[model samples]
Target: MSSSHPTPQPWYKQFWPWFLIGLLLSSIAVSTSFAVLSIRSFDGMVQEDYYEHGKAINMVLAKQQQAADLNLGATLRIDPLTSDAVLDLTGDDRPERLVLKLIFPTEADRDHELRLEHVRDGRYLGQAPDNLRYRWYLQLQPDQETPTWRLVGEGRFPDEGEFALTPGRAADS
Candidate 1:
């Protein structure tokens, strides 16, 4: 009897089929890698006590109003070389020790607070971060509770200049 032809091979064994499968797999691998990278680098900083903050909004506004009533303001200067922060107060009266809070917009760990010492009349001095840049929310207060005012501004380091901090009104927004 005549020899029978070999049975046709399955489609999976063919070169084109394997090549297409590999191409799809490679695309999936690339997309998955990008997704992982984005997740790891995301800076999603949210306040843990958002509810409390929301509840205390009225009090915060009241404090702002208090600052307005007192007509308090200041001029802030940071020396890049010495990392020294100076505040010149312009108001009716000054507190014994003014609290300077440098709050990072997105990173809570980068937030810093300095209890500025009153060097002279309407002048306060404290140590600031050496390498501070980008936008920052500044809160100048005497204590943790009431009598607080917020000043939002951007810090352009390595440049010798001064920034204004007026109470009851945000510098940037």
Candidate 2:
């Protein structure tokens, strides 16, 4: 007597084969996502002339030294209500125009420069844009010849406290 046997299903139809395929597909999906994200988000530093920039540091320091020699001091006040910035300067020479620089660290797009008007003797006033809330690197410079003096400081936006500016450095209130 001869016995008849049933044929087994193909590997493609089997559950274990499909499960293995699913795991491989999932791994590929995750790796592709990571690669896309890595390509999209990159640090913004792309300057190739890093050496030249480093060499220019000396010139910047020299300008600071000029400020130090001039005995420049300024008191900065920011109004919280209107966001208006006022600078009171004390030094030998009074500049006709003052250049105010507001630098937002890590965000170059937000950096601003305002030419302050001389309100009176030893007083400068400028209408800074309102609703600013961030840390800033403040640079107050006189509109003068090259190698002129400047005062540097750091402060939070909408600052109500008083800040004293020293040449090449910042002083806390």
Candidate 3:
């Protein structure tokens, strides 16, 4: 009689265990590759060019700071007259000349510019232009800066003390 056939091996010993191990290894490798690719893309977005842009913006802000530093401790007082206007100025130091600028909130509003004429007793006088309205600013700049006084107050009318200009209201008569 023929010998009994060898017992068939269980499916786990024959192939199933190795198949499961291969599947687990392949899935791990794919996941690792995906994570690596994502990290590389994120780093590429933050380049030196982005830093340069930020520095350029900072430079512009510094220039504005320098301009503001040019004026300090300047006082402007406005006195409205029937025809002409008088501006009295007082501070630690005096400026060679004062600039009066009229600003309009909108294009429809009128704007005017006037140079203050210095008079005795630390006073400046100028003629008020017609059709001026809404808001005005008086800026004072000293001839020198060693004493630490550079620019006086801004958006101030000589007659009115520290008055904010509203859009609809006339800043200076």
Candidate 4:
């Protein structure tokens, strides 16, 4: 007597093999999407001239020390309606024009510099864009190509609209 045996199904038709293959393919697809995203998005967090920036740290500290030596303090106020900015700077020597630097914490493109003309004794006037509604790193400097001193402050803008700056606050430590 002769006995007949049935043939087994191929691996492609097996459940475990297809399940494993599906998992591998899914992983590959996910990794490809993440790679594309990283390639397309440019986060502006890295500086090209990191060495130069490091070298400038000493100069910034010197400027801060100069501001402290001058005993500088200021109160900055902004008008919500007219988008006007006024600063009352207290120090021994005041400049004819002041440079107000508004630096956004995360977005470099949102940084702004406004030149405030000296209106009168200790009063400086400038116009700010009405769209500044976020927090900023503020720096007050003489309107020069290279500022010798700077009064640094930080505050959430438009909501409070008024802030004080002093050389004692670590000068943007």
Candidate 5:
């Protein structure tokens, strides 16, 4: 007796076709999600005015040079419990107010600028943010209509204890 062959299945009813379709759909869904994320969130790395920023780089470096020339240095201590920031500045340049900026690495919106009042000696008093924690870049400059010099440092907040800020790189070697 002859064996009858089974009926061939259509593409829609085949396992291979369904599996391929699932993979394609999954990839499309992933790409769509990525597109949405790109539209919704900012990367914060790109500057809108690249030419202007490039031009300003020299000015910034000049400020750093001024700091170095003035022998500017600072030790900053923060008390998270009391939201107090104590700054001991040492330099030939001493202003009435010091501008201290706690900048979050990736988020410009999270940056906080505190104005420190100059007290007796080299001590300056300022209020730190209550929610200070984790990594932060500290920028210390004299509070002026136009700041001429600046010092930079990096440390973790809340547990900062005492950290020193020194003049960063200058335009000239």
Candidate 6:
């Protein structure tokens, strides 16, 4: 018999499948590791109780007489200036009344509450009493205790950019 061995396969042909498999495995590993690390980092962050608190606050607002008569698609905005809180309310329809509250945590209790008064042109104004500290939230409650009275925005007074409320954060509140 002739002394001959089968021709060796070329490196490209022989190793391509293995190389592709390794690349895929490495990509999966890297992605999995990245996801795990990201989840861990997220878990370590502070969880704001805004959503629960906000729902509770909305429930309270809805119960008020004002919210009962409000028209559809109404919206409210709370603008905290250097010294005062201004509420601007607008919608496809006008609202009969607007209710506002300053919500904050106190030294003794976590729930500190302050009520505000309607100003004009669907605007409401409130002063932050000395007892209420900075970082207090201004909540605009229209039609005071009605299911229609939704939370428009809530955030600290004289807002620092960091404390500005976002849709996601507000929803969680």
Worst 10 residues of 1 by lDDT: 149-158
lDDT value, candidate 1, whole model: 0.77
Name the regions of candidate 6 deviating beyond 4 angstroms.
1-83, 93-96, 105-114, 131-134, 143-147, 158-173
Global lDDT of each model? 0.77, 0.81, 0.49, 0.84, 0.86, 0.48
Q: What does candidate 3's lDDT look like per residue over 1-173, in tens digits?
A: 87888899887787878899999999999999999999886644434588788887555444334444432232344444443655655533345555555544443236565677677665767676743334454333323332222232235333444432221212332
Which residue pairs in candidate 5 collide? none
**After superposition, candidate 1 runs with Cα above 4 Å error:** 1-7, 10-12, 31-35, 42-45, 144-154
**Per-residue lDDT of model 5, residues 35-64, tens digit only:** 999989857556778999999989888988
Of the pair 5 and 6, which is ahead by lDDT? 5
The all-Cα superposition gives candidate 2 an RMSD in Å to the true structure of: 2.7
Tens digit per residue, CA lDDT, model 2, 1-173: 98989899999989999999999999999999999998898666755688998998787777678778877788888898987888998887678789888888887778988878888988998888777787888888877666377788888866688877778666556
By summed lDDT, the worst window of 10 consecutive residues in model 6 runs over: 164-173
Each prediction's number of clashing residue pairs: 0, 0, 9, 0, 0, 14
Q: By TM-score, who's the top model here?
A: 4
In candidate 2, position 162 carries an lDDT of 80
In what order do the candidates fall by lDDT, top score first?
5, 4, 2, 1, 3, 6
TM-score of each: 0.78, 0.82, 0.37, 0.89, 0.83, 0.37
What local lDDT does model 6 show for residue 67?
34
TM-score of 6: 0.37
Please give the TM-score that candidate 3 achieves against the real structure: 0.37
- Total backbone clashes of model 5? 0
